[model samples]
Target: MGLVGEVLLLPFAPVRGSAWVIGQVLNEAERLYYDPATVRAELAALEEELTSGAIDEEEFDRREDELLDRLEIGLARPAPEN
Candidate 1:
C-alpha cells in the first residue's frame, strides 16, 4: 500500500492487530489440543481414574472414546513445518 493508503487505514490498525493476535492464540491452542503426547497423557490419567473407581465404566468409556478420536485425528494431521 502507498503512504496515502496506510494513513487512511491508521484508524483501524488496533482492530487489525487484535484480530492477528486472536488468530495466533487460536492456532497455538489447536496445536496443543491435538498434540498426540498430550492426548496420550490424558488417556493414561483417565485409565487411572477408572482403576481407582473415581469414574464408572460408563464415564470411562465415553471419555476414552473421545480421547481415542483425538489421537486418531492428531495422528492424521500433517506435521507442521518448523
Candidate 2:
C-alpha cells in the first residue's frame, strides 16, 4: 500500500492488531486441542475415571469417542514446517 493508504488506515491499526492477536491465540488453542499427546493423556484420565466409578459407562464411551476423534484428526494433520 502507498503512504496515503497507510495513513488512511492508521486509525484502524489497533483493531487490526487485535484481530491478528486473536487469530494467533485461536491457532495455538486449536493446535493444543488436537495434539495427540494431550488427547492420549485425556483418554488415560478418562479410563481412570471409569475405573474409579467417577463416570458411568455411557459417559466414558462418549468421552472416549470424542478423544479418539481428536487423536485421529491430529494424526491426519500435516506436520508443521520448521
Q: Give stretches of model 1 more than 4 Å off.
A: none
Error of 2 at 38 (Å): 0.3
Displacement of the residue 39 alpha carbon in candidate 1, Å: 0.2
Clashes of 2: 0
lDDT of 1 by residue, 1-82 (tens): 8999999999999999999999999988998899999999999999999999999999999999999999999999989789
Q: Total backbone clashes of model 1?
A: 0
Q: For model 1, give the 10-residue run with minimal summed lDDT.
A: 73-82
CA-lDDT, candidates in order = 0.96, 0.96
User: By how many angstroms RMSD does model 2 differ from the true structure?
Assistant: 0.9
- For model 2, state the Cα shift of residue 58 in Å: 0.9
Question: Per-residue lDDT for 12-64 in model 2, tens only?
Answer: 99999999999999988999999999999999999999999999999999999
| Candidate 1 local Cα displacement, residue 49, angstroms | 0.1
